[model samples]
Target chain A: MRRSLFPRLGLLLGLLFLWLPVLLLAGYAFSDARIPFQWGGFSWRWFVALAGNERLLAAAWLSLRVAASAATLAVVLGGCIGWVLARQGPFRGRPLFGALAGAPLVLPDVVTGLSLLLFFVLLEGATGWPAERGATTILLAHATIGGAYAAVLVQARLATLERELEEAARDLGAGPATTFATITLPLLAPSLVAGWLLAFTLSLDDVVVASFVSGPAGTTLPMVVFSMLRLGLTPEINALAVVILLLALTSAGGALLLLRGVLGRR
Target chain B: MSRPLLSLRGLSRRFGETVALDRLDLDVPPGEFLALLGGSGSGKSTLLRVIAGFEAPDAGQVLFEGRDLAGVPPHARPLNMMFQSYALFPHLTVAGNVAYGLRREGVARAERHRRVAEALAMVGLEEFGRRLPHRLSGGQRQRVALARVLVKRPRLLLLDEPLGALDAGLRERTGFELRALQRETGAAFIMVTHDQSEALALADRVAVLEQGRLVQLGPPRAVYERPATRFVASFLGGANVLEGRPDGAGGLDCPLLGGTLRPAETLPEGCTACALRPERIALRSGASGPNTASGTIEEVAFRGDDSLLLVRMPGGAVLRVGHAEEDGAPPPRGSTVQLSWEAAAVVPLLG
Candidate 1:
C-alpha cells in the first residue's frame, strides 16, 4: 500500500510541477491590478486592453502568419525526408544524410540562430533575394529546425507501419506511385498532423531564433513579450499568455479528437 | 500437358552467405493447384516471391506464358499474391479493397462495382462490403484479401501461407473454402506452406523443399507413399525410417527390425534406408509371424479416431504403430507386443 501511495503521489507532484506555473499565470490574467501578480480582485479589464493594443495585435498576427507558413513548409520538407529514410532502402550517403537530417534537432538554439543569420546574409550577398531579414527569414529559420523535429516524428511513425500494406497494393496492380498515394499517404496522415502541430507550436513560442532573423519590421509576439519583460510585468501580458494557452489547449484537444475519431473507425 | 503456364528454371537467390533458393526448377500447368511444402527457412516463401516479382533471384529465368519476366515490375506482372498477413487496407472498406485493382486498370466505375460484388460474393463476403478490415473476423479478413486478388482476374495466384493465422478448426474450414474458390475461379495457384497435411489435402502436386533445394516433387499420394529421400520420409507424415543397406539378396538388413525387409518395389542403387508408415504396422498380442518383431509398448497416445502406440524393440529402436479405436482397446504401455507389416508397406528410401 505504501509503495502504491508513493507512485500516486509522485504522479500528482509531476503534474503540479508542470502545470502550476501556467495555472498561476492564468489566475493572474483575471486579476484587477496594475501589477501583474498583485491580486486586487477578479476582472476582465486586461483581456479587453489586450484586444485594443494595436502594436501587440499586429505582432500576434505576424507571429500567426509566420507559424502557419513555417509549419506547412516543415511538413512538406520533413515528410519527404522521413519517407526517403524509412522506405527508400540502403543507399550511398545514407548515414551522412541521416546525421544531417538530425543536426538541427541537437544543435543549441543560439548556434542554430547565429548560423542561420550568417547563411541569410551570405545568400543576400550572392543573390539579392530575401534582401533584409524579417518575417520571411524567421519563417525559413523556424521551418529548418521544425523540419528536423517533424522528420524524427514522421520517420518513427513510418517505421512502425506495415510494409505489407504497400506491397499488397502493388500486388493488386497499382503502380509504385499509385500504391504510395493510395496506401502510404493515407496511413501517414495522422503523423503529418501531429508533426504540423508540433512545428506550429515551436514556431509560435520561439523567441531566440526569431530575434536573430527578424529585422526592424519583423518583431513577433514572443519578441514583444520578451521586450515587455525587460521593462515591467503587466497584467495584459498575463492576459496574452492565458489566450495563447487556451488556443494551444483547444487545438491539442481537437487534434486528439480527430485522431481518435479516425483511428477508432479502424 | 499443353504449354506450361509458369516455368521457373535455375532459380537461385542468396542473402549474403545464406541461400534462400538453390537452382530450383518448377513448372505449373494452367489451372493447376500446386503447393510448395517445407519447414522454416526451406525457401518455399522465397520461391513464391520470385514468381510474384517481389524478390529477384540471383540467377534464374521466370517464364510466364513463355515470356521471360526478366525486367517486369511487380505491378506489371500478370499474377497476384495473397500475402500471409492478408495485408488488407485498414482504411478501405471491403468493397473498396476489392475494387482497387480494377480501378487501377482503368475499369469503368460501373463495371468495377459489378466485378467487386461478384468477387465478394464468391468469397461469401457480399454483405461485408461496407465494413473495414479491422472490424471483421480474421477469417473474414482472409476472404477479403482473396476477393481483392480474385477481382484482378490474374492467370496465376500465389498464396503465401494462406491459413497460417487461423486456429485449427477455422484453418481447416477456411482451407476447404479456399480450395473450392480456386476451382471456381479456375486460376493456376502456387501456395507456400509448411503444413504437409494441408499440402496433401489441397494441392494437385506437392513440392517438398529442404535447405533451399527441391527434395521431392510429385502428386500428393506419390510423394507421400514413395518418398525418395530420408528427409521426405520423416517430414511428410512422421514415418518411421529404418537405416539399412541392401543385402544383395533382394532384402534390406535393417538392425532396427532385427531381420531383413523385402519391400515390394526394386530398391534403387545404393539405397540405404526404408520408411514404414505408422498405420501400416499392425500390433498383435502373442506369437510373431513373417515380417514381425517383438517389442515392449513404451507409450500410447489417443488421437480422436485412433491411438498411436510407441513400441520399443530390444535394440532400443522405437517404432510407431497406429491402432484404431474400433480395433479394440490399445495395448497398454510396458506390455509385450508384436509389430508386423506387409512387404508392400515398407517403402525403400535412398540416402
Candidate 2:
C-alpha cells in the first residue's frame, strides 16, 4: 500500500503540474476583470471581445492556412525522401543524404530559423523570386522542418515493412510505379497520416521560425500571442488561449477518430 | 524436349568475395516440375531468382521461348514466385490478393472476379475469399499465395521452399495438394528446397547443387541411387563412402573395407571411392559373397520399420548396416557378423 501511494502521488502531481496553467487561463478567460489572476466576476464579454479582434482573427486564419499547406507538402516530399533513404540501396552520396535528412532533428530551432532567413535573403537578391518575406517564406520554412519530422517518422515505419510484399507485387505483374501505388502507399498510409498531424501541430505551435521569416504585415497567431503577453497580461489574451486550446483539442480528437476509422478498415 | 521452355546459358552471379552462382547452365521444359535441391547458400535460391528476373546474372543469358530476357523486368516476365513466407498482403482479402495480379495487368473487373473465384476454388479456398490473410491458418495462407500466383496463369512458377513454413503433417498434405495442382494447371514449376525427401517426392527431376555448382541433375531415383559426387551421395541420404583406389581391373582396392571389391559399373580411370547405401548391405552369420566384410556388431537401433546395426570392421572403421524388422532379430551387439552387398549397389564416386 505504501509503495503504491508514492507512484499514485507522482501521477497526480504530474497531471496537476501540466494542467494547472491551462486551468488558470480558462478561469481568467471567463473573468469580468481586465487584469489577469484577479477574478472580479464571471462574464462572457472577453470571448466576445476576442471575436471582434480583426488582427487576431486574421493571424489565426493565416496560421491555419500555413499549417495545412505545410503539412500537405511535408507528407508528399518527406514521404519520397523517406522511401529513397529506406529502399534505395547503397547509392552514391547516401551517407550525405542521410545526414541532411537528420539535420533538422538535432539542429536548434533558432539556428534553423536564422539559416532560413539568410537563405531567403540570398535567394531574393539573386533570383528576385520571393520578393518579400511573408506567408510564403514562413510556409517554406515550416515545410522544411516539418518535412524532416515527417521523413523520420516515415523512414522508421518503412523499416518495419516486409520487403517481400513489394517483391510479391512485382512478381504479380506490377511495375515499379504500380507497386508503389498499390502496395507501398497503402501500407504507409497510417504513418503518413500520423506524420502529417505531427507536422501540422508543430507548425501551429512554432513561433521562433515564423518570427524570423514572417513579414511585418503577416504576423501569425503565436507571434500575436507572444507580443500580447510581453506587453502585459489581459483577459482577452486568456480568452484567446482558451479558444486555441479548444480548437487544438477538438482537432486532435477528430484526427484520432479519423485514424481509427481509416486504420481499422485494414 | 519441347524446345526447352526456359534455358539458362552459363549463368553466373557473384557477391563480392563469394560466388552465388558459378557458370551454371540449366533447362526446364514446358509443364515440367523441377526441384533445385541444395543446402543453405548453395545457389539454389539464386538460380530461381535469376530465372524470375529478380537477380540479374553477371554473365549469361536467360532465354524464355528462345528470346533473351536481358532487360526484362520481373513484372514483365511470364513468371510468378511463391515466397517462402507466402508473402500475402495483410491488408487484402484472399480474393483481393488473388486478384491483384490480374488487376495489375489491367484486366476488366468482371473477368478479374471470375478468375479470382476460379483460383480460390482451385486451392480449395472458395469460402475463404472474404477473409484476410492474418485470419487464416498457416496452410490456408500458403494456399492463398499459391492461388495468387496461379491466377496470373504464368508460364513458369518459382516456389522458394514452398512447404518450409508448414508443420510436418501439414507439409505432407500440402505436398500432395501442390503436386496435384501442378498437374492440373500444366505450368512448369521450379521449386527450391533443401529437404531431400520433399524434393524427391514432388519433383519429376531433381537438380542437386553444391557450392554454387550443379553437382547432378536427373530423375529423383537416378540422383538418389546413382549420385555423381561424394557431396551428393551424403546429402541425399545415408551412404557409407569408402576411400579406395582402382585395382586396374573391375574392382577397387579399399583400405576401409579391408579388401578389393568389384564395382557395379566399370570404374573410370582414377576413380577414388565407392559409395554404398547402408540398407543395401546384408548381414549374415558367415562370409558369403565377393564383397564381404566380417565385423562385430557395435550397436543396434530399432526404427519401427527397420533396425540399423553398426558393424565395426577389423580396421577400426564402423559401417552402418540396415536390416528390415521382418528379416529376423538383429544380431546381438558385440556378436560377430559378416556384412555383404551386391556389386551393382556400389557407385563409383570420382572425386
Report RMSD (Å) for each prediction in the order shown: 3.3, 2.8
Question: Candidate 1 has which clashing residue pairs, if any?
Answer: none
Highest TM-score: which candidate? 2
What local distance difference test score does each model get? 0.90, 0.89
lDDT (tens digit, per residue) of candidate 1 on B118-177: 999999998989898889998899999999999998889999999999889999998889
DockQ of all candidates, in order? 0.62, 0.60
Query: Which whole-number lDDT from 0 to 100 does residue B174 have in model 1?
Result: 89
Model 2, B1-351: lDDT tens per residue?
A: 379999999989998989999998899999999999999999999888888888999998999999999899999998889999988987788898999999989999999999999999999999998887888999999999999999989879999999999999999999999999999999999999999999999999999998788889999999999988899988888788888777787888877777666787788787888888889999765665458888888899999999998888887778889989889889899998887888998898966
State the displacement of the C-alpha of residue A9, model 1, in Å, after optimal TM-score superposition.
11
- Share of native C-alpha contacts between chains A and B (below 8 angstroms) recovered by candidate 1: 0.75
